[model samples]
Target: MIPVKILTSEEAERLGLKKPTKKSGFGIKGVGCVVQGKHGGEGKLMEEIILRENGDLELVFMDPEREKELKSRRQFTGYLKQFTKIPEGLK
Candidate 1:
């Protein structure tokens, strides 16, 4: 019932989060924080689980921390003016 944001690499570093040896080769290792949640309950958590050759794996939430950084990458936004003309067939 709550909305949660992703984690950033910097926030994970300051929290003393380190790579887990036992879970190595499984995926990325780290935890993250969430901003807020529903009814003031526990917020969402973020963490890395595995890492692959192509850098694709599962990231899970283990614990939620407050005031942590958001996601690492920003969303892509195309230029509005450049999109003025639509394809003839599509319309």
Candidate 2:
């Protein structure tokens, strides 16, 4: 599965998802079924996601198109000094 960038509230609205509502009770918003758009999607499907209380969004990857179109920032997590000698002047 390819990584997709998380969308902001405003971004989601702009992308066609409904705006957040106070009355919308939530454990996980996008659940149960894969949101599919027929007619106008041009064969593309709408990916589902969960909106967390802290505004964290989780995308459920059911379709494979995301792998071809999505791009994520590459992050190096391992400690650099463990792999090489520490450089001087910046310590």
Identify the leading candidate in terms of lDDT.
2
Could you tell me which 10 consecutive residues in candidate 1 have the lowest summed lDDT?
71-80
Give the alpha carbon lDDT tens digit for every residue of 21-56 in model 1.
Answer: 456653434422334567858854433233343344
Model 2: per-residue lDDT, tens digit, 3-84?
Answer: 9889988888898787467635545543322444567655555344455554445444335443233323222222222222
Count clashes in each candidate, considering only residues at least 3 apart in sequence or on different chains: 6, 0
Error of 2 at 32 (Å): 14
TM-score of 2: 0.29
Model 1's C-alpha root-mean-square deviation from the true structure amounts to 21.5
| lDDT for model 1 | 0.38
Using all chains and alpha carbons, the TM-scores for the candidates as numbered come to 0.19, 0.29
Q: For candidate 2, give the lDDT.
A: 0.44
RMSD of model 2 against the true structure = 21.8
